[model samples]
Target: MRRLPLAILAIALLVAGCDDAGASPAAQGSTAPAASAGGACQLLDFGMVNAKLGLDLSVAAGASLDNTFTCVLQAKGVSYPDLVLAVSSTTIDADVFGDMIQPKNATAVQGLGVAGYQMPTPAAGKAGPGVEVGWLAGNKRIIELSLRFAPGTPDQRAADAVPKVVELAKLIDLSSL
Candidate 1:
């Protein structure tokens, strides 16, 4: 339809602008650290995301392609509240994640993964009101979490940020991706 989510957000902003070349320490403004042990942002922690999405981020950046691995958390000299976690070890199913990564009217999350969904943030720029949660884990790898806020947050906080992005997507483990 709409050019497939704008061609998957233009190949995720051209693979996050080919990462490293962008000098990702949160892209030079500095602040990307944390996320070490087993990388890929260690499926997020940072004090359980500021005690459940009350966010203080404290930066953490990452990027990869050929098997996907993206982690970004923010808030150290501002850049709107941010939290993005992506993982993909290939192996997709459930009709290719409901016809290529769900999204169009998403809202089916029922037990974390093996096929789940959630939506919002289709527009709201300046990092206000957002929420997203995707799944397909049971080893079929494919996660995607999102949370944005900061810019007069409180539009019911994007429906209260959807169960806090399904409780951080049920503390994502998926064989410790």
Candidate 2:
């Protein structure tokens, strides 16, 4: 009879312990990363810099201007137009913004400096069919960094381009900019 009582007590303790184990950190009211105030931008860490950008997304109603930096390249007699790094209140869409540009198969990478921040190689690729787009995000923002290579360019050149984008992403200041 004593052994039966001890066994019952042990089972009770085990059940109590299981209840504690099932409680998640969130359920315990743990703190989460701080979200942006306007819910427009997110912060990102790309190994070298820290920054935030707009996501070009509108959550509720109003349309806002995209906050982005851009540069153009004219190499090897080709006009690579429409290179833009713009941030919106809701989305960060970086792309080669012009229509006359084409993806060049040549693997040429360049960097730009904006107000002391190095803009990452804007996500490079074609838009559709021959277009490519890349995106990265933080808890508070969505970053869509893209590029359009001059036609006849292979994707391999574009593969090496993402790190530059990561580098540039580090410069965004989501809290204020």
| Index of the highest-lDDT prediction | 1
How well is each residue in 6-85 modelled by candidate 2, as lDDT tens digits?
A: 22233233222322122111111112321221112133221121122111111111112333222111112222312223
Task: Summarize candidate 1's per-residue lDDT along 78-108 as a digit string, tens digits.
Answer: 6566777777766658777878777678888
Best model per TM-score: 1
List where candidate 1 sits over 4 angstroms from the true fold.
1-38, 42-58, 61-72, 77-80, 88-91, 94-96, 99-104, 107-128, 131-140, 154-177
Each candidate: what lDDT? Answer: 0.64, 0.27
Q: In model 2, which range of ten residues has the least summed lDDT?
A: 54-63
**Candidate 2 lDDT (Cα, 0 to 1):** 0.27
**What TM-scores do the predictions have?**
0.34, 0.30
List residue ranges in candidate 2 displaced over 4 A: 1-78, 91-142, 173-177
**What is candidate 1's CA lDDT for residue 18?**
32
lDDT score, residue 109, model 2? 28
